[model samples]
Target: MKYSETINSLIRKGLNEVNHSINGHLPLSIRREILQTINEPCVIGKISISCALKVYPIWNDFFKNDTEIIGLIKQSEKFLLGQINEKELLGNAEHLEVFVQDYNKEDNIMVMFAGMTDVHAAYDVLTSGGMEECVSDEEALQNPDTWDTAFIASLAYNGGAVALDAINHDRNKEFWNWYLTDCIRIAFFNDKLPYPPTTSIVSAKYFSGNNIKEYRTQPNIWKENAECRSRMNDIKGILVKIMDITHWTKSDFYFYHVGTASYTQVFYYKGNELVKFNLDINISMYLSRKVEN
Candidate 1:
């Protein structure tokens, strides 16, 4: 595609903004995000404005990253040019954006996680308001061995107590909460959400008759079926935020099954409509358990 003076200006502005944001120690993934956002409008087509109008969540969430700013400019370029193709101009939409791959060519992706802890003491003592049980005793015993960062973050914190402990450990609970805020994601640009009708199974049977014809029947299993859902989402113009933490253990070998607090959101143009989507998911992280050897 031909570049206009305006496009060039936008690109320059984007590069500068991104460079500063990275503080000159930019990683390749971030750099790609900046490039994709700045060039999206020029390459795709008004996706930016449309998304701003319909997907405020995405706009609000990703505004923290340089990619969002560049994406707006790129969308402006596409809108002005009127060069959208059939696939590009679907749904009478505005923005058509794509995600940035890493310098290593690894696609940008985020994972979910869950975490836990173990104690020689009873669960009550560990959770109760007894310093001797949960704090001092464990500390004096040098039993940092049982604290599972991911596990404690997921399950124990469900009741707010673990949250308290988390705050005490880092003393930066406020920062961590803000860090893991929810955001929506878009799968692709110029894509439309496909809505399908629900289905029902009127009758299901397991071969349980005693006759030779029905001989040796096994129980038939059934599961709740869900229709597939799809929509257009652009990853290029959005910022994905993820949280990372490494827990400490006292024993050389302690085991933990935990989840990490990380996620992603995207902005998209489906024809003329804009959309935002999010996923609050979980995954497991494992560490060897500490045992008296």
Candidate 2:
């Protein structure tokens, strides 16, 4: 289907922003080449179609003509605008079941799964365990809610991977490393913890685990340890300097699990009193690596 000039422009603008944000962290040489590749007319068509497929996976029906693709884009825009609810969004993602069949048959499953992971991760966070306590999509727009950590982390991973695909369809280790660091920072800022809890979050962990024991056994150890200090410094810089999430009013820190192997601790602060704390067990591996080194 031929989208109206206006609709086409809107879609382009929205996609450009996504591309630009993803490229911002890339090195100058790689970023320029990637932007050039993504800006190509043919590639844009594939990207648009891919994004549309994420929303409406009826391959035979949707891929038959441009009109169906246009409709898919419109549906996605509505979800973005908060005009549609989470129920509708998930329903649309379910269409991927059909979409995946063709993707796998064509040997493009890995590329497609990269995008699918984001949707599945978001779905898991919303429905799994205690994540339901996190805020809704509508609430997230106005304020940074605890759930935003999972939602955004999933997106960051997907976005980084997609951006890598655009460049050369190869995994870029540097981009992912930076992206993970940023996700941890953002999660910490939006944590929901109560102020002045009976026990300190960090202290409790120190007594319970060998991992924590290592850090606590040595005074100023994390500071003296280069790798540990670097990670801690990265987190501190993100919490104190980088993030602009001001909507979160709660003072809490809590551990949020993104997946089995990955988790993040979100620490929300109030006037420097350290009111809340979140520690993801996944971070223990990173710390463990540092301890070994």
Candidate 3:
């Protein structure tokens, strides 16, 4: 079951992941790794509420008189306490779904999406807990929701990125480091960030050989995407490829994001090996380094 395919499915999968984690069903980030240890809905509700509050300033600026949205959130909270029925809570979200059509697609789409999904993560996941599939970075980017802390934390980072982009459209690697680290800390670590468990090596016992499963760049799909065609890519083709074939996504071994110099490079870490690929054709021949285990 594709979680992001529909709101109900997303919620069901979210609930499922929290109950029994099989990996890949959650958001791409491992920050929510701890949530799997405890299958508590209230914790998710609390985190969702906090994320919404953190981004409230941005949402408020773009949308005033947000009564319906507020009601949806409040109803979500009520549902968590068993105060309201599922239909009542869902009715509220469904109503705002109509309004979000206008609120979305703006410059602050991430901001709005973060807030919208905030309500979703809180109320929907309380109902079910069964999801399907682990998508790679390419697919993960297209679908970013794990219906729990993994998702909420990821969206907080995404929304902040959009806001920062709106400001100056320039952010260095260090900023990314701080942002992701801080988000993980607040969400799972109780404001404590463990020094990254892995440094620079595919040789660590921490990773699997299949950390990066498949990667390829398809110009045909890029040309079909209006957003892709508009961007002035050197190759005029988008990098659309599967991530790790294992439980890990980029967020699992996500050390930090550093852009390649006039290049598009994708890195995947496996047990004691990190594979770097520069694609121009199919996935294998384009491998920058011979796969070593």
Candidate 4:
């Protein structure tokens, strides 16, 4: 009847539904492990049981559509649970070849951004001279539609001064300036922007030296910087590092980074324990954006 009780009831219901859905498919031990994970009170990465339940229908649709992959996942889960040996798991994996091909055919930006593998693919395409082929610096400066223009605009619209500070404070000031300038130059030659305008738009004046100074003098930027600093400092027992892309999926730490950024941070727990932190690029950008206002 009470609000807290209602939330607890919902969580229980969601966990029951998930357990029932996977029942008789995966090994009992595997199911139990998954249920334990789903029932955790705190967040995993950014995913919570409440959020997972709310999005169940969408994920269910995918499960139904890819029964083969689901089967493989079940087998994989069994292997992970020690119900099956590695040899047995590899035997089951052979059948995945056909399914893997079909799955690749359905790939798009949304899919690419969802998992670790796809994240790497997206990053590679964006950084491997593909971005340069799309827009030029001169064109980006002149046209609002250019990727360069939109990237700068997006930073400004999203809080460029804050973001600049995040990068400078968390990383280094020199890297921040280089990144900003490089993005501006690349936007000019870019034929298409990778992300939608709503996510990447920013003002042109922020790129100008005099305008940047005036913009930084605003009181709001300082306020935001203070708030962000407090939040970062509050994350005790977690160490953030900017490292190469290979570190994204490391088992020892929770990884977060924007593909556009040169490096990603691996956040390690105090005692080298594993935590199910979700890899969220948006959150990474937001936290990092809090640099010296």
User: What are the RMSD figures for all models against the true structure?
Assistant: 26.3, 20.0, 14.9, 23.3
| Model number with the top TM-score | 3
Please identify model 2 stretches exceeding 4 Å from their true place.
1-83, 128-172, 186-293
- Indicate which candidate wins on lDDT: 3
State the RMSD for candidate 3.
14.9
lDDT head-to-head 2 vs 3, winner: 3
lDDT of each: 0.24, 0.35, 0.41, 0.31
- Specify the poorest-scoring 10-residue window by lDDT in model 2: 211-220
Which residue runs does candidate 1 get wrong by more than 4 Å? 23-42, 45-293
Q: Which stretches in model 4 have alpha-carbon errors above 4 Å?
A: 1-60, 63-66, 105-293
Query: lDDT tens digits, residues 1-293, model 1?
Result: 34345444544554454344312211223223333443443222222222222222222222233343233333333434544433333222222122211211211011000101111111211122112223432343244344322222222212112222211222122212211221011212233321111221110011112210111111112122121111111111112222112121111111112232222233334445444433333211210111100
Encode model 2's per-residue lDDT on 1-293: one tens digit a residue.
23235433443443344445532233322322332333433222232223233222222222333343333344443444357776765675567534544554222333334334334433432232123334443454345333322223222223212222122211133323333333222222323211122233432232233522111011235656787668665555545542356544443212222212333345565555443354455654554443334
Candidates sorted on TM-score, descending = 3, 2, 4, 1
Write one digit per residue (lDDT tens) for candidate 3, span 1-293: 11122433433444454334322223333323333333455544544554454444334444555555555656666676679887777776666666665655534454556466556544544553223335453455455453443344334333333221121112122222333334323434352212122123321111123442111111233346665435424222323224423432341111111222111345555554556644555533323212110
Candidate 2 vs candidate 3: the TM-score winner is 3
Runs in model 3 with CA error above 4 Å? 1-32, 128-138, 144-293
